[model samples]
Target: MMQPILTVAEVNGYIEEVFPEVQGQYLCEHIAPMEARVRAVVGPQNLRPGGTVSGPTMFGLADCGFYMVLLAMIGKQALAVTTNASIDFMRKPEPCDMIAEARILKLGRVLAVGDVLMYSEGSDKPVARASMTYSIPPAR
Candidate 1:
C-alpha cells in the first residue's frame, strides 16, 4: 500500500484554507492508501421540506470525500477536478450528520475513479452511493 501524501488533519486544513466557504461543514476524519472517511454536518440548509437530507447535499459530500482521498494519495492538486459523477439515492437520509467513506477504484496517470458510500449519522445503512471520476492535471 502506498503512503498517503497528506494526513487526515492536513486534508481538513487544506479544505479549510482553500474552500473556506464550506469550512466547519465538511471534515476529513481518516485517510489511508486510496481511501478517506469524511463527515458532513447536516444543517438547516441541507434539510429538505420532508425533513430529510437533500440529494444535492449528499452528492456534495460524496464528491468532496472522493476528492479528499485522491488528494491524500496524490498530494494537493487543486486542479484535480471531478470529470463525471453518478449518484444513486438509496434510502432517505436522516436529518443529521452524514458520513462518507470513499475508495479509489483506479488511479491512472490522467484519471482517477472512486466510489463513496454515505450513511446518516449512527446508522449502519447507507443512504447514498456515488461513483465519480476525476481528471488529474499533469504535474508542473
Candidate 2:
C-alpha cells in the first residue's frame, strides 16, 4: 500500500498558516490513499442574497478538497496550481456546514486530476460536484 505523504493535521495546519483568512472555517478532515475529506462551515459571510450557500463558497470547498488530496499524495507542494476546473451546482445547500469528498482520478509526475462532491452536513444528496486538474511543479 502507498503511504500518505502528509497527515490530516499537517494539511490543516499548513492551510491555517498559509491561508489564515479561512482559518476555523475550512479544515482538512482526513486523508486516505488517493482521497481527501474537507469541510467548510457555513458562515454568515458565505450566504448569498437568497439565503443559500454561495456558489463561490461551494467552489472554494471543492478546490480546497482537491488540493488537499494532491498534497496528501505528493507532500506539501504549495506551488501546485489548478490548471482546469468545472463545477456543477446540483442543489441548493442549507445554511449548515458543508463537506467535500475528493478522489484523485490520476496522479502523474507533472499533473493530477480529481473530482469532488460537496454536501450539506448530514445530507445524502450532493449540492455540487466538481472536476479539477492541477499542474504539479517540478521538484527543485
Candidate 3:
C-alpha cells in the first residue's frame, strides 16, 4: 500500500498547533496524483530585494517541509531537530512565489534525510537545491 500524504488542512492544523509561523510562509499542495508528494510554496512576504526569493526563505520552507513530511509519515513529534543543511543557490528566482518539493532520502531510528528542490513560481528552472538532515528523537 502507498503511504498517505498530509493534506493542506492537516498541515495547517499542524502549524496552528506547533509551528504557527509556517502557516504564513508556506502552503502545502498536492502536486501529483500518483506519487502523493507535498509541494510547499512561499508567498510574497518571503521575497527579498531584486524580486528574488531569499536564501533564508527557502531554508525555512525546506526545514518546515521536512517537518511536515516526517509528521505525515511517522506522526507529529515536535522534538525532531534539523541537524544539517547544505544548500546551493543556482540562480535568482523570478519575482513571484517560491516552490519547494521535498522527499525523504533515508529514514532511520535517529536520523532522517531529505532533498529539496526550490524554484520560482511560474518558472520552469530550479533556483536552488538543498539537502537536509533531521534528527528524530528516539521513541519513548
Candidate 4:
C-alpha cells in the first residue's frame, strides 16, 4: 500500500485555507495508506423536520471524507473534483455528529474511485454509503 503524502493536520489546514466557510464543519480525523476518516459536526441546521440528519448532510460528509483521502494520497491539489457519485441511505441517522470512513478502491493518474460509509457518532452500523469518482488535475 502507498503511504499518504499529507498528514491530517496538513489536510485540515489546506481545507481551511481554501474552504473557510466549511472550516469547522468537516474535520479530517485520520489518514493512512488508502483510507481516511472524517467527522462532520452536525448541528440543528443539519437536521430535517423529523429530527434526523438530512441526506444532504450525510452526502457532504462522504464527499469531504473522500476528498481528504485523495488529498492525503496526492497532496493538496484543489482542482480535483468529483466526477460522479452515488449514495444509498441505509438508515435514519441520529441528530448528532457523523463520521465518514472513506477508502480508495482504485487510483490512477487521472481518476480515482472510492467509497464512504457514514455512521452517527458511536454507532456501529452505517446510516449511508457513497461511491464516488474524482477527476484529478494534470500535474503542472
Candidate 5:
C-alpha cells in the first residue's frame, strides 16, 4: 500500500491558507494510504426543514473528505478540481456532526476518483454516499 505524502496537520494547514472560508467547517481526522476520514461540524445553519441535516451539507462533507484523501496522497496540489460528482442520500442525518470515510478508487496522472460514505456522528448506519472525480493539474 502506498503511504500518504502529507500529514493531517499539513493538509489542514494548506486548507487554512488557501480555503480559509471553510476553516472550521470541515476537519481532517485521519489519513492512511489511500483513505481519509473527515468530520463536518454541523451547526444550526447546516440544518434544513424538519431539523435534519441538509443534503448539501452532507455533499460538502463528502467532497471535502475525498479532497483531503487525494491531497494526502498527492501532496498539496491545490489546483486539483472536482470534475464530476454524484451523491445519494440514504437516511435523514441528525443535526450533529457528520463523519466521512473517503477512499481513493483510482489515481492517474491527471485524474483521481474516490468515494465517500458519511454517517451521522456516533451512528453505525451511513446517511449518504458520494462518488467524485477530480482533475489533477500537471506538475510545473
Candidate 6:
C-alpha cells in the first residue's frame, strides 16, 4: 500500500488555513491517517446533569472528526456539505474525556462517506457511533 503523502502537520495546517473555526473543543490527533481520532477532556461544558456527555456535544465531536478526515484526504475544502448523518448512542461515556475514532468508508469525486466510533477515555467499549455523508462541491 502507498503511504499517505501528507502528514498530520500538513493536514492541520490546511485546516487552520481553510476553516480556522472548525477546530473544536477537543484536539484532533492522527490527521492524514486512514482514520482519524479526536480526544476531548469532558467538563461541565460538555456534560448533562447526570454527568453524561450531551448528545449534541457528541454529535459535534463526530461531525468535526468527519470533516477533519475528509479534509485530510481532499485538502482545504471548507465548502464540503453534510448530506446525511445517523448516530447511535451505544453506551454512556466517561465523565472526564471522550475520544472519537473516525474512518472514511468511501471517497468519490462528489461525495464522501465516513463513520465514527466514540469511546469514553479509559474505556474499551464504544459510547456512540456516527455515520455521515458529505457532498464535496464540484470544482469551481
Measured by lDDT, the strongest candidate is 4
Write model 2 residue lDDT over 1-140, tens digit each, in one string. Answer: 56678999999888887778888877889899999889998889999988899999998999889998898899888899999999999999999899999999989999999899999999999999999999999999
- Candidate scoring better on lDDT of 4 and 6: 4
Instruction: Count clashing residue pairs per candidate.
Output: 0, 0, 0, 0, 0, 0
| Per-residue lDDT of candidate 6, residues 109-131 (tens digit) | 99989899999888889999999
- Which sequence of candidate numbers ranks them by lDDT, best first? 4, 5, 1, 2, 6, 3
Which candidate has the highest TM-score of all?
A: 4
Steric clash pairs (candidate 2)? none
Q: After superposition, how far is residue 40 of candidate 6 from its true place, in Å?
A: 2.8
- Tens-digit lDDT track for model 5 on 9-105? 9999988988999999999989999999999999999999999999889989988899999999999998999999999999888899999999999
RMSD of each: 0.7, 1.0, 2.8, 0.5, 0.6, 2.1
The parts of candidate 2 lying over 4 Å away from their true place are: none
Candidate 1 TM-score to native: 0.98
TM-score of each: 0.98, 0.96, 0.83, 0.99, 0.98, 0.86
Which model is ahead, 2 or 5, in terms of TM-score? 5
- What candidate 3 gets wrong by more than 4 Å, as runs, is 31-45
lDDT of 6 at 91: 83
lDDT of 3 by residue, 1-140 (tens): 33646555775577668876655566667423111234455567667877777778778777776676776666667888999999999998776677777777777789988888777777779888888898998889
Q: Which model, 3 or 5, shows the larger lDDT?
A: 5
Cα lDDT for residue 11, candidate 1: 93
lDDT per residue for candidate 1 within 1-140, as digits (tens), equals: 77899998889988898889999888999988999999998999999999999998998999999999999999988889999999999999999999999999999999999899999999999999999999999988
Candidate 4 stretches greater than 4 Å from native = none
Residue 119 in model 3: lDDT: 77
Candidate with the larger TM-score of 3 and 6: 6
- RMSD of candidate 4 to the truth, in angstroms, is 0.5
Report how far off residue 94 is in candidate 6 (Å).
1.2
